[model samples]
Target: MTQTIAIDNSQKLQLAPLDIPNRLLLGPGPSNAHPAVLEAMNTPPVGHLDPAFLGLMDEIQSLLRYTWQTQNQLTIAVSGTGTAAMEATIANSVEPGDVVLIGVAGYFGNRLVDMAGRYGADVRTITKPWGQVFSLSELRTALETHRPAILALVHAETSTGARQPIDGVGDLCREFGCLLLLDTVTSLGGVPIFLDTWGVDLAYSCSQKGLGCPPGASPFTMSQRAVEKLQQRKTKVANWYLDMNLLGKYWGSDRIYHHTAPINLYYALREALRLLAQEGIENSWQRHQKNVEYLWAGLEDIGLKLHVQQEFRLPTLTTVCIPDGVDGKAIAKILLNDYNIEVGGGLGELAGKVWRVGLMGFNSRTESVDRLLEVLPQVLSK
Candidate 1:
């Protein structure tokens, strides 16, 4: 048999420049990055262990504390996305056979239950109807029944655009010997977050939503009580990378090695925090609130309806019901393809029924509000 050797001639692929549209992102998350934030992302990368990089990390943590309004010592940015920090917090806090009470008010609330279950927790959920807030009576009853090791709730439920009340629930969790875990990814920089005053033991958030930074970093804080509980845990955290013990060393003064931090994302996050500080947290909240009003005013004029009630709607994100005879997904497609604007379709149980419109951070300006409002009538007419 004569064997013929064939030469491989596959060409190395050439990189192509991506041509992106000038989109006004009015979607659920990744609203819009300020120009300053984009510039920050262009900064040169530095080694994770370099003194300058470590210094930047320290500043990032301090700014996150200011943004979160928490003085918790165990505060830092997880190197991945929002869900990473949320999973880390739960996996570190709950051990096998532990009971966790999750408040399922909307889509993100159900995510809490799933995360807790992944850590071998017996997840007991207290659910409210979509677009509704949990009543104090219902919460109190669930607390008495479950007596869980942790009480988890979403401060701003992104899917339903509902804001859950935190004051009473935080106090109840503390009184019932349950650590309070809050998901504030959509509420952190755009709203008032008094983590220390509210008795939140641990909270996690993302930069893409309210912070107006690109996706990649998850900002999280852990109260002293949560820290002590982790220290006393009988078993090691299931996930090694998210292990609070090792992560603490990297984020704390000890400065031990954990993983290679995403330098450019940190750069963008730092600038985002700087912008938030310049705006002032209270003022940022008011900005979102004002734009939400403007959105509702325009929406009502167009004969559209909001999904969540006025009293409980999230200022940063709004869920609007798709009008009859119009397809929600089709409207979104028109906005993206024709208008160069992006808004989210519904999620979970509310899928295809509602549209999620986010007035977050840099995207909360009057111009953005006007752009979406003006284009809506045209989109709906088709």
Candidate 2:
């Protein structure tokens, strides 16, 4: 049954039908979702705890394990964006007055320092210039000097398009008895991230970028050691909604009610992970690398300079130095308005000096790269 109310002309709302333009996403995140993923999102909703949904949850966890390349039992998708997962990891692991050391090189690294401090940790930061990554020795010295409980770093810094190398940093954490927390928001599926082999105790990422799903559900994992730290925490987690212990109960076998999970978003994530599995994680990594190389070559051919060096460049996102006398914002607007292509501008210290371009997940294709290359020069010239 339905009821309708008649309203005066003055009272009537001026709402119109919704219409969204089709734009190619070549920005830092929220990359174009796969067709199958979008279809899955449109599927009929189910109760979060329904039997069928629970089965789907199990499948998601299994697939997440495969994607993260870890056997950590606490691996699950947090109920919010990547930042929520970041908060969860920090709030659960850091107690009041605990010392935390962060390797800061870009915007997200600074974000980690802020989050850790808000959790009542004494934050110590060792920073390099935005486009440069910390060396292994620098990390070792920081850990030895700060003697913090956790050493956090960003695996792929989106702001500056720099990739931090973590080959031996984990061993240094072990020597100093510090837990290793990493932000993989841009690198998870697009790059090689072996959580266990790399000794990452805690890690978090988003679905929108590398997972090729809409933003909402975030991938999160914690090693057994991290779980032990949470179990032994003296104080209640600062944030209730992001409490890992409570979230673990809901995401784990207990299946207790925490909140109404974003049912459709989970559906989309499941399909996205399935697509990744079908393509093979290694193959996905190779695809991103190959596509980015092509993009770099094209940009170079057009006389554009990349901000990051070749050795430590991020494959998923690249920072193009804005040529002198060219307005970065204008170029981005022209591309969006005239070409229906979306790209990102710089953040923090790099603003107006560079443009952040991303080729992630579904957008990491030769065709998309070629289209951007074709329009980029025209946009810059204008």
Candidate 3:
């Protein structure tokens, strides 16, 4: 006979069920999930390996392919946040001692540098100011100097609201016999990206941003060129969970068991993707552009200066310059507490210098822009 141990109850406080406040998320990355996505997430979950769930998995892959405008058969969702998918791309492609060149213009770019270095790659970086983007000629010069095995870049720098132009980068990578890895975490559903056309070899994105879904499963895909590199790597991927060879078996026809999938998150992601497809990706891009322009006009009208140059500005997020003698964090807090509006303060080099405002996914609307513009002037006056 076994005696059960009594659990201590003194430290446990009785609390009400979670009641979250409602706020319009006008910040970087997550910009509020759609109501439909929330409802889909609430649906009862099914077994991860159930036939129905597997079918949903297939649908998700297809939708991701469409969303990314890539036909890579290995496209799949990683069972974690955007960072997990970001790590997956690095782990699968980089081998110890391989020269990896990364573009570092903002916070996330630095994140790639850290992740790549941890994976044992000899990392080289081409840097720019926080709100500036690289030129094609500069990338060509860097490729000539490093001649690296992989070239990684951030298509949209969330921290600085700068969009890196990648139209001719793929050809440059091919010319250098290197693979092109792109971070589309902030640009995926809202920005205009033709992955296959641009010849991007590997890319990753988050569910919560342009996808209009909550933070959980993330989109990841690799081109045949990148897959070949992975297949020929001398050593096994250092991270087992992110090892694509094994993950491929689970996502591919092998259907092998890997980790337990986030069923409800997948449900939400599917609904969000479906809605995006219905809206037509091109239309969504246009919508984001129009709304962001409206937001830019409104912000300028309120005498706020934007951080990024007009040519490099992103449609999804904008970095607003924080005027001298004004507190960016305090304004953000007041907007959250009083106005029920959420905007983000800057990160890294831009810290205390700018405020990050996002018009992404379901929040990219004239109404959202108007609301933020209405409160910003009042807050600044005080």
Instruction: Please rank every candidate by lDDT, starting with the best.
Output: 3, 2, 1
Off by over 4 Å in 2: 1-13
Candidate 3: tens digits of C-alpha lDDT, residues 1-382:
6769987999999999999999899999677999999999999988888999899999999999999999999999999999999999999999999999999999999999999999999999999989999999999999999999999999999999999999999999999999999999999999999999999999999999999999999999999999999999999999999899999998898899999999999999999999999999999999999999999998999889999999989999999999999989999999999999999999999999999999999999899999998888999999
Best by TM-score: 3
Total backbone collisions for each predicted model: 0, 0, 0
Cα error, candidate 3, residue 163 (Å): 0.1
lDDT (Cα, tens digit) per residue for candidate 2, span 1-382: 5759765698678889988899999999889999999999999999988989988888888899899899999888888999998888898899999999998899999999989988899999999999999998889888878999999999999999999998888888999999999999999899988889899999999999988999999998999999999999888888988888888888888999888889999999999999999999999999999999999999999999999999999999999999999989999999998999999999998999999999999999999999999998877776
> Comparing candidate 2 with candidate 3, which one achieves the higher TM-score?
3
Considering summed lDDT, which 10 consecutive residues are worst modelled in model 1? 6-15
Q: Write the per-residue lDDT of candidate 1 for residues 1-382, one digit (tens) a residue.
A: 7769876668766768997788889999888899999999999999999998898889889899999999998999998899998898898899998999998978888888888888899999988888998887888999999999998888999999999888877788878899999999899988778999899999999989889999998898899999999999999999998898999999889999999999999999999999899889889999989988999999999999999989998999999999777789988999999998999999988898899999998998899989999999988987
| Superposition TM-score, candidate 1 onto the true structure | 0.96
The 10 consecutive residues of candidate 3 with the worst lDDT sum are 1-10
